[model samples]
Target: MDTDLTPLRDRIDAIDRQLLELLNQRARHAQDIGQHKHRAGQPVFRPEREREVIAKVLQANAGPLLSDGVTAIWREIMSACRALEARQQVAFLGPEGTYSEQAARQFFGSSCSFAACTDLDEVFRSQLSGSSAFAVVAIENSTEGAVARTLDLLLAHPVQICGEISLAIHHNLLRRHDGLDGVAAVLAHPQALAQCRQWLDKHLPGVERRAVSSNAEGARLAAHDASLAAIAGEQAASQYALQVAAPRIQDEAQNRTRFIVLGGQPTQPSGHDRTSLILAVPNRAGAVFGMLKPLAAHGVSMSRFESRPARSGAWEYFFYVDIEGHQDDARVARALDALRQSCAFFKNLGSYPIGRE
Candidate 1:
């Protein structure tokens, strides 16, 4: 006999039975917790708690399965348990197969409901209108840079950033045809098209590139037209039943996008956390330097700093900054107070756990 997989599979089946029993037990306990939370008027979805559980599961994974594979299995199990508690409806910038929808599903899971929004404004509006409890939208992408519309929406909306998620982007060129002989135009969001600019230039130099509202929308359009190809994530390719003409087409191999979860309430400190702020510096000399000195002196490490034109007047601008400590931390509190006195203005964007891998 070459080998006997029967005995190994039987043992695995026994272990899987035990796991199923434990998972059901966990679900019951989760439902009980949900009941208590509802009675106490607390939010059912706790991102920090979920992060802790994911970290624990990923650490305990030993062999055979990769970290991401294990995480996906655990996420689905957790998603089922959460569904027992209650269904949560989330909205994202979408036309069904967009990256924002993928990010939302990655953060929330398959069991939860999702609503598609045409734009970032619609994402916020859906939540405001009581149509969605939470919203997910991209903040920045490593290859193409910050999404200006998302930044502008954050300024206009009063929502707080409750959680953050980073998604690795692998753009695929999808089409329904057997070959690219007759393909005339490549359609995708401007960002997606730009991310794969080199690849498109090399392969389809003379083909016209058209911008669409979203990559998913492009995929949808491509579904009906044989002459078009969509550059979108794998999920879109699979969802639309399109053949992948090309995959991993982004110019940057390490392409990733940082997305944020927006909700009405702020989050409590989760120990390992980050805080975001939007402030304005005076026009005088060393304005930016003076405004950030307090954070440096207080030992609060800055993670991100960006600027956007302010609505007040010409040449007026606001600075967006992310620092390493929760707002309630003593040093962080002191830094915020000191900055208020030195800066022209400041808006606290809320503190949240630095979302884990």
Candidate 2:
């Protein structure tokens, strides 16, 4: 004899219907808020506000669902609501299927519009030209370190960081044919090629490595050329209709890349935030040490510090620093004030809510 399960199924269906009704109510309220924002000339998409919402929900959560799952569900709901007000136009490096694209979708959600650019420079240009409201570009990689072009563009462009994403990258060797036979060369972005250097050397010895604008672009090229195998992500393999000759070809198993979300205005203080800056100290003895003393004195914590060449004839370096607090915080403000006196050049790259791993 079999036990009857119709009652449980009926209960689940009733709960699902209730959930749908509640969701619709939330969406209606969101639409009403959007109308008010439009009348007040306020931005529809506010990262800080979204962060606060997520925090509140997480604080109230006591369930079998994990924090990540809850955050993702709420984000999609918020994204859809914001789109009803005004769909955000976002830019990223691509022809589509790049990790940069993935980061953009992750941050903005799939409700926003995407403008794919051929290069990082174009990604900035699209936003500056008003073609896109936001731009996402990879700034650093765990294995390969900083992306120099993105760093340079950040300095040159008027855009600032409003948010960030940390994406775990998994590279795959994709080709048109079934197997890796007749594969003459490996194509991918320079960073991708470097990330998978050990794997390529051991497997496809003596294959010429060609760097392209992006891993997706390499995959696109490989789709048409049987002699070339591209190193890209699973998304590229699916997008280009290529077969994954070999998966997870990167040297490191847990390779990750950090991408920054760029926008025109500075984000409001989110209690938990990170402030990025670019500084050049006076060319003198103890100048660098003096520049850092304020943080120690004020009891502010620093998360990252890197030096990029100033590219001037004289040897000067620009120090990029990421500190733990918003610029408005008393301690951070005091430290920045004292820090400014020792610098020849200083640029605050905006404070944003720190991205979760």
Candidate 3:
């Protein structure tokens, strides 16, 4: 029986045409805004504005499509519109197929090209050298407190945090064949290996585990060696042509990694925002209290706090603080001004939108 589709076909075709026209119209307006922004000396990408737009669309959503589905379609639309003005070049820690790359794409969309670096330092360097417009680096993992190297780099570099992304870490045990028998060693990034430690101990007990540069690299190596397995993600499995020997092998079911987009400029507050800082308290008595007192006084709340070795003098350390407001907020500004005096050293890492995928 032939379904009566004439009316539906006509409606779909008409809607498709209208959609194309609307997209182009939106692109034209975006280009005009880009020109205006250029004349006013504004950054091409505004994370806060993007977040606001996404939130608005999600709030307006009331149909068959979920929030993520709406976001996926709108991201490409915005990506293309942004490209009509300028396309971004992003750098990430990778040999390709790294979670860093995934985070970069999740934030930047498909309009941009990526510069894959061998190490995190290279990712930063790419941004500094103009090889990339932005750099995405993993700052912290839910399962592993924080990435110490990223924290140190944040202090050492002059780059600002323009945006951030949180990616759920689903570690997959990949293999050349379906069977795990005769597997000699498991290869993965050190962090990936650690995240899957308990699972490996229980399932692949007594097998030698080796650390590699990246999980994707481990997958690549595993693809070439039949006797080896790798702990990586789906991207790695596809990129290296490996099978999913086991899925979700991480110790924690709710593993997530937070990545920051570093650029030369900072983000403007979009109502909802976050600011990061690196500071050290004075050597005097009650110095820590002095450092934190202003935040309470100004009603500025803290979201995270971690300390790292100062690396210069013994017992001297730098505290990485994540506050729940933009640096420009009146109270936050007051808190920072008051707290500045309590520190032997201080650096404002950056402020960025709090909401992200």
lDDT of each: 0.87, 0.91, 0.89
- How high is each candidate's TM-score? 0.93, 0.95, 0.96
Candidate 1 TM-score, C-alpha based: 0.93
Give lDDT tens digits, candidate 2, residues 104-223. 998888899999999999999998999999999999999999999998988887778899989999999999977777889999999999999999888899989999999999999999
Find the 10 residues in a row with the least total lDDT in model 1: 1-10
Inter-residue clash pairs, candidate 3: none
Better of 1 and 3 by TM-score: 3
The worst-scoring run of ten residues by lDDT in candidate 2 lies at 1-10
**lDDT for 257 (candidate 2):** 98
Q: Report how far off residue 169 is in candidate 3 (Å).
A: 1.1
Off by over 4 Å in 1: 1-7, 311-313
lDDT of 3 by residue, 70-163 (tens): 9979888888898888877999988788899888888888898888899888888899888999999999999987988889888898888888
Task: Quote the positional error of residue 73 for candidate 1 in Å.
Answer: 2.3
Best by TM-score: 3
Q: What is the lDDT of residue 234 in candidate 1?
A: 79
